[model samples]
Target: MTGAVRLEPVDERNLEPLLSVAAAEAEPEDVMPPVDAPAGWSLARRDAFREFHRASFGGLAGPTRTAMYAVVSGGEVVGMVRMTRCDEPGVVETGMWLGRSARGRGLGAAALRELLHAAAAAGMHTVVADTTPDNAGALSVLRRCGAELREENGKIRARMCLDSAIPIR
Candidate 1:
């Protein structure tokens, strides 16, 4: 049960859809900043999404850059993934979120794997990710991707080498 996974660059044409998905999937305990809509969605949530989208898209600029992409599966915008900024030069840290309708379908792992492929193709030597200990879904994805795990500052950190396979934790 696999769907075609593709990466679409975040641009003006796809920006609204991305924001809508973010608003729909907002979770209170999400590791990343939430871009949720307000209860009535008249003011606060709209403003928050605007700021988040602006900052996020702005980060796409320049030579030393971070890449953010919309993860599309079966032609629907399911989520977003990115290589976040890291102090290490050759390592890219990744994170993603699936919309409510897209959860529990194994899409998260698919998206992460695609991100890993992209990172490796871009000359990244290693990839890293982190999630809370209790996030079984995320932990499962990391484990399935064969990421090496360690606990740091009370969070579970996962690292993988693009040049070789790792023992899943």
Candidate 2:
């Protein structure tokens, strides 16, 4: 059976391990911004990945504050989830990606549940996520999390209102 999944704060100590999982079990595009390197994870790409996480923590000084978490399961770092403050007050945008080896195992849903809880606890009134229509795995997780989904242009957007008094699922 798959182990229970949890979200731990992403920090210096665990960042390397998280990057290792991303390099070995996930495509760089799925986890980071587009890189000009070769198809595989290259040296420059790895450095960029580290910088991305580093910047995520610095969001507090900017207009948008972002919080990132390492997706942990079975005592291993398998993915990441993040919540970013949106331009709208009381609203936050969320995104997540799991290593290929960890996909389709209900882990994404579990991580999203934790992310939603975090959002509510952070005093967010709404949470939103956007993905392409072809990303079936993401769509499934959003639906399972009770998000209201709609397709606009070529993107599928999911939104959910937070109510801390009630449990998610």
Candidate 3:
């Protein structure tokens, strides 16, 4: 079982652990390309990712935004999730990953449930996610997280309509 998870605003404190997970979870077929993979999350890649995070955070932010968060459980950041605005005015897209040590538990679902609620409370009515076809784990996470799924242009698109009264998990 996984412990209770907390969502913390990404900052200098939790950035390293989050990036470390991002590196460890990297795969060649990943949509985000796992940053500096093979070589692992190298220093340069880490810096660039951080810079991108800062820029994305600073750009057109609202209560609902590409809000970067560290998924904390048992006093550590086991994963990270980001919610960004989509072309649809009230829709947001989410992306997330867990470290190897954090996989196979119910943590991802619980944490994502929280993330969905956060986005809903922030005025986002829907959340979307896309995953590679071969990413079974991600597909499962989408189903378990209460997102509606579809295949489009070779990727699985997960869409979840959020309501303040909706109960996830």
Which model, 2 or 3, shows the larger lDDT? Answer: 2
Worst 10 residues of 3 by lDDT: 28-37
Backbone clashes in model 3, listed as residue pairs: 66-83
Q: After superposition, which runs of candidate 3 have C-alpha atoms over 4 Å from their true positions?
A: 1-3, 23-38, 59-65, 164-167
Candidate 1 lDDT trough over 10 residues, lowest sum: 26-35
Best by TM-score: 2
Tens-digit per-residue lDDT, 23-119, candidate 1:
6775523424555555534467666655554556644243436677888988878777788657787788888777878777777777777778878
Which prediction has more favorable TM-score, 2 or 3? 2
Candidate 2: misplaced stretches above 4 Å?
A: 1-3, 59-64, 164-169
> TM-score for every candidate vs. truth?
0.81, 0.91, 0.83
Worst 10-residue lDDT window, candidate 2: 55-64
Local distance difference test, per candidate?
Answer: 0.73, 0.86, 0.74
Better of 1 and 2 by lDDT: 2
Candidate 1 vs candidate 2, TM-score winner = 2
**Candidate 3 residue lDDT tens string, 111-146:** 788888888778889989988899888887788877
- Write model 2 residue lDDT over 15-62, tens digit each, in one string: 999999999998898898897877788899999899889887654334
Error of 3 at 69 (Å): 0.5
